[model samples]
Target: MWIQEVGEYSKKLLDKGTGEDVVTYRRVQGGEGTKSSQQRIQVNGDGTVTIPKKDADLNISIDNGEHSNYFKNEVRGGNADIVEFDVPKWFDDFLKENTIPQSGYNSNPLNQGGTAPKLVDPTKPGNSFEVPAPWVEWIEEYAKNAQIKK
Candidate 1:
């Protein structure tokens, strides 16, 4: 039989100093017999994500964007990644602020938005990624940034 192990997750309404809502997630390694290490990730108000055991300042906006586009293409093996339907208003605004403008070209009617899905709340319930634990930073970034209230 094939099985995978997963860690637990919890959401905190207020951070110690920032008082932003944070989602803390624990991730498991492999299978039942495999040894696992717990990692903590935090998203700063500065738009940088830090993972203790992994690299710090991982802004996976692109990663989340790519995963969000999985269904439109389906090249990836597993199901489509999770798309945030409960996106907060400010987070939506941030995405709007960061829109990579299409400067050149455009005479034809073919070129348009980038491959990644537009950063916005999905019309229907959607998945961002299959494994949420590894993407804890993104979750918190999206969550905290939404509540940060520029």
Candidate 2:
């Protein structure tokens, strides 16, 4: 049986003007613990807070609530080191402005008014077809550029 003894938890405002604070907690035996601290600027008349855009020490955000446990597991395993940036107001507007219906690739041959040749299935034994001339030429050019021999 393993037991964790937590001790010495403290919270202090590092910068009261900026609403920046630090909360530190430590465990007694294994020296393992968690500290969750956040700083935000109160947006005037908006009832919103703005988190600063800076390199984080350890930041993780998940859209789905179910993934929270998984995040905790990673933190315990010392695998949670990636820092994430909270999307800004302008990013949401940009996403709305650039929104488009999902479709085939913009550079797809079919979309570009080019006929794409259908190749025979290679999984079927004894089923084969001659490679298209244009495709062969393209492969030849690609190999020449890559300096690879067939």
- Which predicted model would earn the best TM-score? 1
For candidate 1, the C-alpha RMSD (Å) to the true structure equals 14.0
Query: Where does model 1 exceed 4 Å of error?
Result: 1-73, 79-85, 102-139, 142-150
**Cα lDDT, all candidates:** 0.29, 0.24
For candidate 1, the 10 contiguous residues with the lowest summed lDDT are 1-10
TM-score versus the correct structure, for each prediction: 0.25, 0.19
Candidate 2, which ten residues in sequence have the lowest lDDT sum?
Answer: 1-10
Q: What is the lDDT of candidate 2?
A: 0.24
lDDT of 2 by residue, 27-101 (tens): 111112553233212122322223243222212221222232333343333332222122322322222233221
Candidate 2 residue spans exceeding 4 A from truth: 1-47, 50-58, 73-150
Q: Indicate the residue-level lDDT of 103 in model 1.
A: 33
lDDT of residue 11 for candidate 1? 26
